[model samples]
Target: MNSSRHYVIDFDSTFTQVEALDVLGEISLENQPDKDERLQELKSLTDRGMGGELALRESLSLRLDLLKANKNHLAPLIDVLKGKISTSFVRNEAFFEENSDHIYIVSNGFKEFIVPIVKELGIKEENVFANTFVFDDEGKIIGFDKENVLSSNNGKVEQLKALDLKGDVYVIGDGYTDYEIKAAGLANKFYAFTENIERDKVTEKADHITPSLDEFLYVHKMNKAISYPKNRIKVLLLENVHPDALQIMKNEGYNVSLQTGAMDEDELAEQIKDVSVLGIRSKTQLTKKVLDNANRLIAVGAFCIGTNQIDLEECLKKGIAVFNAPYSNTRSVVELAIGEIILLMRNLPDKIAKMHEGNWDKSASHSYEVRGKKLGIVGYGNIGAQLSVMAESIGFDVYYYDLVEKLALGNATKCNSLKELLQTVDIVSLHVDGRKENKNLIGEKQFKEMKDGVIFLNLSRGHVVDIEALKNNINSGKVNGAGIDVFPSEPKTNKENFESSLKGLPNVILTPHIGGSTEEAQENIGNFVPGKIIEYINTGSTTNSVNFPNLQLPILENAHRLIHIHHNKPGIIAHINRVLAANDINIVGQHLKTNETIGYVITDIDKAYNIEVVKELKEIKDTIKFRILY
Candidate 1:
C-alpha cells in the first residue's frame, strides 16, 4: 500500500452537513419569490433521486438566471458554509492538517463556493481541483466554464487522471461523478462517503461505505489515537417489538437492557441515563429533555412505522440518527386492515362481544357479509394499496382517496374527494400518514356526510380521526361499529397501561395499535429493523432507513460485505469501488437500498479482504463508518 495515496473528495453533502450548492441556490432566489418554484423543482429533482451534479447544474442555472447572484452573494453563502461545517469535520482538524499534502477537493461544484470553504478548513488553494464559476461585468453570476473537465460527465475521474499522480488515487463524494472515477480507472479506491448522502448505485460499486467522517479517519488510521474513555451505550427496547430485536442487538455487541413497561418523560430519562441507543415502538415519548439528557446517544430506533413519538428536528440538531421499520411491518398492518374490515362488515366484533357475554344473538339482520360490500380507504401508500389488492381478492369493491395521486390495484376506484368516498362506501378504513395536517381529518362534518350505519375503522394515525366524534357516531347508530387501533395520545413506554376514550363502548373493537402486530410482522421487524439499527451502528449501513438517503445495490457473491449508510447525495459508491478496483479486489455481489434520509449498500468481495482496504475506505469524506460484515 502506498503511503502517499491522493484522496480526492467532493463537496456539497459529502464534505459539509448540507448541500452547499443547493443552499446557495435557495438563498440566491429568496428575494425572487417566483424563483422559489424553480428552487422547488430542483429540490424535487434531487429528492426524486437525481444525482447531485445534474441537480446542481439545473438548480445553479435557474438560480443564476433568477438572481444574477455574483461575488456579493457568494460572501454570505460562504458564511453559511463556514457556519455549518459538519461537526465531525470541525472536530478532526488535526487529521486535515497532518494529511494536507495527500488531500484534494475534487468537485464539480463552483470553485467560487468551494474555495472559501476550503480556506476555512485551512486547506491550501493549490490542493483544490474543481469547476470555476465565471461572473459577469455587473458582479453577477452568469455562466460556468464548459471546457473544464470537472464541469462535464465523468469529469472528476478525468480531472484525477489529469493530475497524473504516480501513487494510488482515491475519490470520496456523494454524487455519480465521484463513483465514475472508479469505473474510469482513474482512482485506486472509492469510499462511499455517506455522512452526507448515500446513493444506491454508488454504494453498490464502492469498496467501502461510511456514514460519518470520524469513521473514515478511524478506519484509515490517519488520526492520532487518544485513549478516550468508552461511552456506555445503554438501549431501551419497548413494546410491540419482538423480543428478538433486543436479542439481535445483544448479538451485535451492544449493551442492551430490556424494560417491558411504559414510563413518562422523567421516568424514561432516569431509566435511559448513561444510555446511548434508545429503541421503542409507538409507545415511547422521546421528548426534548429526554434527548437533551441522552448526551451519549448516537442513534434512535423507532421499532414501528411512525416517528411522531420522537422529536425529529431535535434529533437532527443533536446529530442523532433515527431508524424506523417502514416496510418490514407493512404486510402486518395491511393484513390487519383486511381482517378488521371484514370483521367490521360482518359484525364479527359485535357477535364476539355478545358471545363473551353469554348472549347468543344469532340474528342475521345486523350481521352482514363482507363480500359485495364497498371498502373505502384513506391514504393509498404501501399499507393501503396492499390492503386494496387483498380486499379485492376477497370479492370486495375498494375505493381509495389520497391527497397525492396513487396507482390503484385490482378493481379499486380512486375517489375524487374524501367526502365522496365517505358518502359512497360501506366500510371506511383509515391508513393516512402521521403528518400534522392529518390531525382531526375525519371529524364531525365528514361523519355527518357518511352513510348511516356505515362501519368505520382507524388503523393509521390515532389523530387522523376524531375519536370523540367516532364514539358518538357509533353510539347514535350513524356508524354501526368501529375498530380503533392507534390513538392520538398513546403511552410512550410499553409498560405503561392505557385507557382509551372509546373503551367499553358497545360494538367497538379497541386494539393496542397492533394493526401490524401479527407474529410474522413481529418476526420480520425483529429480524430486519434491529438488523438495520445494528448495521448503521457497526458499518453505517442505512438499508431500511425511513428518513435518510436511498441506496439500492444488487446482492454480491464472494466478497466480504461492506455496508455503508450515509446521507443521500452522489458519488460515494464510486469512491468506494474505485478503492477496491485500485487494490485489485474484485466485487462479487452487492445490495443497496435507500429512503429519504439515508443510503444503505452491502457489497461482497471475491477474496479475503485486507484491513488496508477498509482503512482507505474510511478516509473518504462524508463517511459515517465502515465495518467488515461476515
Candidate 2:
C-alpha cells in the first residue's frame, strides 16, 4: 500500500453527473434558432472524444467552436455543476479534502468552470491540470489554450508522465483518456468509475470496475462502509408518495417497498422494524414507539411540506435524520388556491350542481367576477405569497396577515392583525402551519367577523380553521361559498367513509385534500427529498436535517471518523480530544458545531488506535451518541 499514491480522476461524467460541454452548449444555445443542431453536434463530439474514437484536441476544438457561450455563463454553469457532481463522489468528498495534496483532476474540460467546482472540495488550483479558454475582450469564449498538454491526444498520459515522480499512480474515471494513463505505463492501476454513466469500451480496458467511488475505496480496504452500493439498500415508501421517488431510490440500487395509502401507527411500527429508509406523506405518523421498533432505520423522508406527523425529537435522539420537501409542493398548493377562489367567487359550484341534476334555471343574481374582490391571506409563506400575486393579477385586492413580518409582493397590502384582515376582505384563505398554537387559528369569532356573503377556503392545516364554524356560516348565508380541502378528523384511507360538517351544502366544495397533488409537484418532491436522505445517510451531512444539528464535515482519507452527537455543553470537544490523546491517537482533522440543545463533533484520526478509544469516547460527559466510521 502506498500512502502517497497519485489519484488522477476524470471530470465530465466522472466527477460531474453531466458532461460539462453538453451543459454549456445547452445553456449557450438555449432558445436560439440553431440550438438543436448545435447541441446534437456538441453531444456527438463529446461522446467520440470520451470513447477514445477521436483525437482529444480536435474533438474539444470543434465542441468549443460550437459553444456560443460568454464569460457570464460560466458562473451559473459552475453553480449547476457543483450541484450535479456524481452522487458517489459527492458523498465521499471528505476523502478528496483530506488527501488534496495527492489528488489531481486531470480533465480535458476547461479550467474556468472546473476550478470553482473542485475548489469547493479542497482541490488546489495547481493540482488541476486542464486546458484554459482564450476569451475575447467582450468576455465571449473564442478559443482554447492551444499550447496546453490537456488539449492534445492522450493528454492525461502526457501530464502524468510530466509529473514524473510518485509512489504509485491510480487512475479512476469513466472515459478512455483515463485508461490511457495505464497504457502509457504511468498508472499502476486503472479503475473504471461508472456510478454516473458507463462507457463499455472504457470499462472493458480497466483493471478494476466499480459503480461508485466508495466501491473503489472498499476494494482497497479504505472505506468505513460501502454506502454507495450499486443497489442493495432497503427503502419503505408509504402514503402514496410520487413514483418518481421510488424510481430514484431504485436507480441508486436500493430495493424498495411502496404502498399507496397511510397506515396505522401500530402497523407502521411492525412494518418498519427492519426498514433502512422510510418515506411517507402527511398521514402516517412515526411516533416514538414506532421509531423504537425500527431497528435498522437510518433516515426518514417526508414527501410533503410539513413533518409534523413524524416525531422529529425522538428520531434525532435515536441518531435518525428527518428530511422533507417543503419547497417543491408550494406552487401546486398556490395554483389550487387561486383556482378554487375563482370557482367560489362566481358561485360556480352550486350552478354546476343544478345543471348536473338537469335544471334549466339560469340567473346571475348571486354570481360575481373576481375583480374588485378583497382576498385576505393568512400565514404569508410560500403558497400564500404566491397566491397573493396571482389573485392581484386577476384584479383582486390582496391583503396578507402573518405573525412574522413578511415582504409584500406586487401591490399586496400587509394587515396589522388577522382580525383587521377579516374585517376588510371579501374572501379568506388559510395557509398556516401545524404548530400547537395554530390548532384553531380561525374559529367562531374569526368567522363571525367576516363580511356577509364572504367566500372561505382552508388549504393549510386540517385543524387550522374550525370546520363547525365554517359550516354554520355557510348555512346562515354569511359565507356565500366555501372550498374546504383538509379536515381535522379525516379518514385514513380514500375508501374509508368520510363525515364532515361542511358536506351537503349547496355552494360548499369539498375536495379530498389534493391541493398539492399535481403530477409535477409529486415528481419534484419524490426526487428532491430522497436525494437529501441518501446524502445524509452516506456522508453524515445534516445540512437540511429538520431535527439534527447541521454540520458539513470534510471527507476523511486513510483515517477513522468519529461522529459524536451530544448535549450542547462547553468543553465537549476538548474532552473528546483528551480521551483520544490519552489513547495515543493522532488527530488529523476535526469539526464541531453546536445548537441550543445539541452538539455535533466530527473527529478524524489516524487508524492506529485500539477499541478502548471508542469505549473512552462513550464515557465523555454529556455524550448522547458515539459511532466510528472509517
The numbered model that scores best in lDDT is 2
Where is model 2 more than 4 Å wrong at Cα?
A: 1-233, 553-560, 606-610, 619-621, 627-630
Kindly list the per-residue Cα lDDT of model 1 for residues 428-544, writing each as its tens digit.
Answer: 988888878889999999999999999888999888888888888888999988888888887665556797779878778888878888888778777877777666654445555
Q: Candidate 2, residues 144-195: lDDT per residue as tens digits?
A: 9888989999788788889985688889999998998899899899999887
Deviation (Å) of 261 in candidate 2: 1.9
Q: In candidate 2, which residue pairs clash?
A: 94-554, 94-555, 95-555, 224-630, 231-253
Model 1 poorest 10 in a row by lDDT: 224-233
User: What C-alpha lDDT values do all the predictions have?
Assistant: 0.74, 0.85
What TM-score would you give candidate 2 relative to the actual structure?
0.65
How many clashes does the backbone of model 1 have? 68
Model 2 Cα RMSD, 1 decimal: 10.1
